[model samples]
Target: MTIASCGSVSATTLGLPNSTAIPAEKARLPKGLFVAKIPVSAKTKQRLANDIESITMLSLLQARNTKLAAGTRVPEILVIGLRLHEPNAAVPTDIVELIAMQRKSGMLFVCVRDADFEGTTRQECAFAVRRALPARAGHTTTSKVFASDWQPAGEATLNATDPAVDSMDALWESLCSQVILDDPSPIDVNTRLARRMQIAQLTAQVDKLTRDHQRAKNPEQRNEIYAKLHKMKRQLEELQGQ
Candidate 1:
C-alpha cells in the first residue's frame, strides 16, 4: 500500500530540518508484500514481519520540492528508520539491500534499538547508507552498505557540508560520509566505500588465517597460515594507507 504522507513534523531527532520531516504510519509496508513490486525470499519476508517493530519514514527529500539539488538519476532521498522488536537483534543485510534496490532511491536507514549506556537503558541508533547507481539493462547496482557505529539515538547529525554541489548525487555522497564516522578523509565517498569493502574482505581473510594458524598441528602448516595472514594484513594496511 502506498503510505499516506503525514503532515510536516520536526525531524530534529535525525538532525534533519523540520521542513523535511514527513512522518508516515508505522505500518508503511503492506502485510504480505515487498516494496516497489520486487520479489523477496520467504525468509526475508518473515524476518521483516518478526524483527521489525515499526517502520517510519522520517524524511523524504527530493530535488524539486527540497533545497537539495537535482540528481541526474536520483530524484529523491529517503531517510527510513526501522525500530527493532529486540534491542540486540539485527536486521539482515540482504533485507536492507533488497529494500533499497526495490525502492530505487538514495536511502539512509536508521536502526533503532534500546541499549544500556552509562548505567541507564536508553535508545540508540546506527546509520546505514546504500546508494543505488543508475540502472543498467533494467538491473540496479547498489554500493556496499556503509554504516556508522551506534550512538545515542538522535544525537548524531549529518555533518558533511558542500555548498557548491548542485545535485542530489553529491548530497547523497555527503550523507554517506556523515554515516561513516570513522573516515574523515577528503577522498570521494565512493572511493572511501570501496576501500572500506576491501578492508572488510582482507579482515575476514586474516581472521580465517588466524584460526587456521591456531588449529595447525604441524610447524609447516602454521608457517603457511602465518604467511597468508601477513599478506592479508599488508593488503589491508595499503588500503588503509597505514
Candidate 2:
C-alpha cells in the first residue's frame, strides 16, 4: 500500500497504510461536515443516501473522530455514483454544472460505482475528476488524481448488507490521507457561518408556512397559503443548491 504525506504527517503515522484503518484524530474529516450525494437514477440515489447514512453511523459507533451527514448546503465532498450500462456512457451536462459549483467552493469530488453495478474504468473515473476539477492555468502541476480499487474487510463485508457502506468507509480513508485533493482555499469561515444562519432562517419560514397551510379552512385561503409555500420552498432549494 502506498501512503502520501500530508502536511507534516505521514500516512502510516495516521494509521492509513491501507484503506481499512480508522483515521487518526488529526487526519479525520471535519465533524458535522456535509457530504452531497449525486446519483443520476432514483435507485442509485436511494442507495447512495443509505450508504452515507451507514458510513456516518459506523464511524460514530466506532468512536472515530469524524461526524458526517448528508446535507443540501454547499457540501464538503460530492460523491458521484454512476452505473454505466455502456463503455461510452455520456455524463450529463447538469451533473457537470453541479460539479463545477462544488469545485468552485473548493470541495472534493469523487466518482464511485452504483450498488449492484459494474465498476467504472480508471479512465472513466479520471475523466470525471478532470472535468470536475480543472486546474488553474499556472497551477496545472499541482493537480493530481488518485485512484484505488478498494475491497472491504471480511468483517465489514459480512456484517453490512449494503456494498455502498463499505465503499464509503474506504473513501473516507482515502480522504483522511490526502488520496483526494485537499481544498487549497476553503470557503471563508465567516461566509459559511453566515450561510448556515440564512439557511436556518429560511427553514423556520418553511415550518411556519407548513403550519399555516395545515390550518387554513377555506379553499381560497388554502390556495393563497399554497402559493406562498411553493415560492418559499423553491427559494430554499436554490439556496441549498448553492
Candidate 3:
C-alpha cells in the first residue's frame, strides 16, 4: 500500500511502484474478448500476439490513495506495462484502443524492449496516453492514443512540473503533453489533439493530390489538382501555426 508522490513514475519503470506489482495474467485480456467486443482483423490479432511479450498492471493512481486531487473527468489512472517480443517493433494500436475503450479510468501504456547497442544489451521504453472523449449528442464516445518517442530506459523521465496539474485530468493532460509535445500556444490537450488529427488528414490529402497532379495527362486536370493541393497546404499551414 505504497503511494507514489506527484510525478513519481520515472521513465525507466513507467509508473510501476516497487511494492505493488499485480499478477501478470491479470493484465491480459481473455481470449476472444477483443474479437467479440472490438472489430479486430485477424492480422491485427496476430500482430499483437507476435509483438507483445507480456502485459502487467504496474500501478494505479487515484486521489484517495495518492497526493493528486480527484478529477471530475478522470477519477483514476491505470498504469499498464507491456513488454515487447521484438526489440524494434511495436504492438498494434488495435489492442490499446480496445483496452482503453473498455476501461473507465485513463489508460497509460508503457512499452519496453531490450535491444543490443554496440555489443551491449540496453532497454528502451515508449509511453502511450489515451484520451477518451465523452459521447456527444447522437454520437458514440471515442478514444485516441498518443504515443511518445522511444527513450533509453535508464535516463528518460516523465514531465510533471506544470503548476496547472491540480487534478487527475490536468495531470493526465501534462503526461499527454510529454508524449505528444504540446502546441506552442496555450491550448488544452484535447484541442491540440484535434488540431493534430486535422493536420494529419490534410497532409494525407495533399500527398494524394500531388500524386494525382503528377499522373494527370490533361492540363485542365493538372490545374485543378494544383489548386486543391495549394488550398490544402494553406489549411495545413494555418493549423500548424495555431
Candidate 4:
C-alpha cells in the first residue's frame, strides 16, 4: 500500500512503504523489472524454464538482433509450490523434500499463473520474466503484496547470475582505466587472463548464494544463508569498489 518514489524510471520496486526512499537499500537487494509466481508442479517447473528462455538473449549480438537489451525482461524469482499443504493432504510426498533434491544441483524452479496482471483469468501465461508488470511493483509477496500465496521472492537473477562473468568484465574495464586505481597494468595478456579467471571463480560462489537466499522457502534457512551471502557480497564489492 505504501510506495516510495525514487524518480527512477527503470524497474518498479515493491517493498515496504518507503523502502525505495531509503538510500542503499535497493543496492544491497536487487529488484526485478517484472514479477509473477505459479504453483510448483512438474509441468510448472518445466514451464518456468521455458518462461525464462522466452525473455533471455543468449548473446550480445542476439540481443541486438531481437531488439532486446541484456538486462531487459530478465527474471528474479520467488519460488512457489514447494510447501506442505497442512493436515492429511495426501498429495505426492513432501514438496519441499522434492524441491530440496533439485536444490542440491544449485538450480531453482518456480512459476506464476499471472503475467501483467491479466485479471487471474488463467488463460494467458506469463513466464518468470515478462514484458509488462503492475504500474508499481510488489515482488515481496507480503501481506500488502502477494498475500494469498505468501511466497519468498529472492534477488538471485536480478543483476548478474554469474559473479565470475560480471566481476571479471568489470575488473577488465577497470584495468583498462589504468589512469586511476593503479590497476596493476594489463600490459601482459596471459597474466590478465589468469588473474581474471581466478577472480571469477572466487566470486561465483558468493553470487550463487545471493540468488539462493532470496528464493528459499524457509525463513530460518533463508536468513542463515543470507547472512553469509551479505557478508560475502560486501567483501567482494569492497574489493571491486577499490
**The candidate that achieves the highest TM-score relative to the unseen native structure:** 3
- Cα-based TM-score, every candidate: 0.74, 0.25, 0.74, 0.21
RMSD of 2: 18.8
Show where candidate 1 strays beyond 4 Å.
1-10, 23-36, 92-94, 131-144, 163-165, 180-187, 207-231
Give the Cα lDDT of each candidate.
0.66, 0.37, 0.67, 0.31
Best-to-worst lDDT order: 3, 1, 2, 4
Tens digit per residue, CA lDDT, model 3, 1-242: 33322122332245333443444445454445546766777877886667766565666667765567888988977777667777666634666776677777777777777777888977777788766653446988776777787777765466444677777777767777777763222137666667777898999999999999999999999999999999999999999998
Model 1 per-residue lDDT tens digits across residues 5-123: 21211255555655566644542655355543767788878788887776667777777655766887677888877777776555446656766766676888777777777787777
Model 2 lDDT, residue 91, Cα: 37
Better of 2 and 3 by TM-score: 3
lDDT of 4 by residue, 6-50 (tens): 111112222211311223222221112222233456654543343
Tens-digit lDDT track of model 2 for 108-195: 2322222223654332321123222233367644333333232211111111122232333333333422322222222232344345
Off by over 4 Å in 4: 1-195
RMSD of 3: 5.0
- Which model, 1 or 4, shows the larger TM-score? 1
